[model samples]
Target: MRIHVKLYATLRRYQPDLPRGAALLLAVPPGTTVNQVLQQLAIPDNVPLVTMVNSSVCRLDCVLAEGDTLNLFPPVAGG
Candidate 1:
């Protein structure tokens, strides 16, 4: 399946080779979960994942489907 991923905030640094704010097209096998995608992208396991699928918030265990658009943002903090 093919999915579009958008990395935001500090998470953008994870893929420095990719154009900032650009949607990345990834080809993943069937039954892939959000967590799996992040792992494949080299995102740290402990990093907080704020994810949205097609504009709705979803869990990391959410299964991905073809044409799914995923927007992922790492947890942000400020005082």
Candidate 2:
């Protein structure tokens, strides 16, 4: 299965050196969850962040489907 990954803010560091704003096409086994992908990408699971799929907030255990777009956002802080 293939999923589109869009890393925002600091998470953009995880993206390969490709064109800007281009979603990384990741190939994972069927039923692969968000947590697994984060692990594979070497993203620290301990980071306070939010994960969304197709614009909807989702858990790391959520199963991803082909063509699904996953976006990761780092925790925001403002005074």
Candidate 3:
């Protein structure tokens, strides 16, 4: 299956060495969860992150769908 993944802020650093853009079209197997995608991208799940799918906010356990757009953002913090 293929899905679009977008990384923002610090999370963009998690993207693999490739063309820079608003998102990346990733090829993942069926049943690929957000957590699995994080691992595959070398992004630690333990790290604070905000994940969304198709415009709706979701958790790491969220199941992705073919052609879905997944966006990942690093949690914002301030002093």
Candidate 4:
């Protein structure tokens, strides 16, 4: 299956070849979970992930579907 991934904030470093905020096309097997995709992208487990699937917030174990647009952001911090 193919899914589009958008990385935000510090997580953007994972996609150095892509323009900031550009979507990346990724291929994974059917039934792949969001967590698996993050692992495949080498996103550190300790990095807080704020994820959205097709504009709706989702958890790491959420299943991915073909044509899904996944937006991932690192947790925002401010005083």
- Which candidate number has the best TM-score? 4
lDDT tens digits, residues 1-79, model 1?
Answer: 8999999988888888888779999999999999999999999888887999999999989999999999998777778
List TM-scores for all candidates, in order: 0.90, 0.91, 0.86, 0.93
Expressed as tens digits, the lDDT of each residue in 1-79 for candidate 2 is 8999888878877765846787889999999999999998889868777999999999999999999999988989888
- Candidate 2's TM-score reads 0.91
Top candidate on lDDT is 4
Ranked by TM-score, the better of candidates 1 and 3 is 1
Model 3 — TM-score against the truth?
0.86
User: What is the per-residue lDDT of model 3 for residues 1-79, given as tens digits with 9 covering 90 to 100?
Assistant: 9999998877778765755666888999999999888888888758888889998999889899999999888777888
The number of clashing residue pairs in model 3 is 0
What does each candidate score in C-alpha RMSD?
A: 1.2, 1.2, 1.7, 1.0
lDDT for each of the candidates?
A: 0.91, 0.89, 0.86, 0.92
Off by over 4 Å in 4: none
Q: Order candidates by TM-score, high to low.
A: 4, 2, 1, 3
Residue 56 CA displacement from its true place in model 4, Å:
0.6
Error of 3 at 42 (Å): 0.5
Off by over 4 Å in 3: 16-20
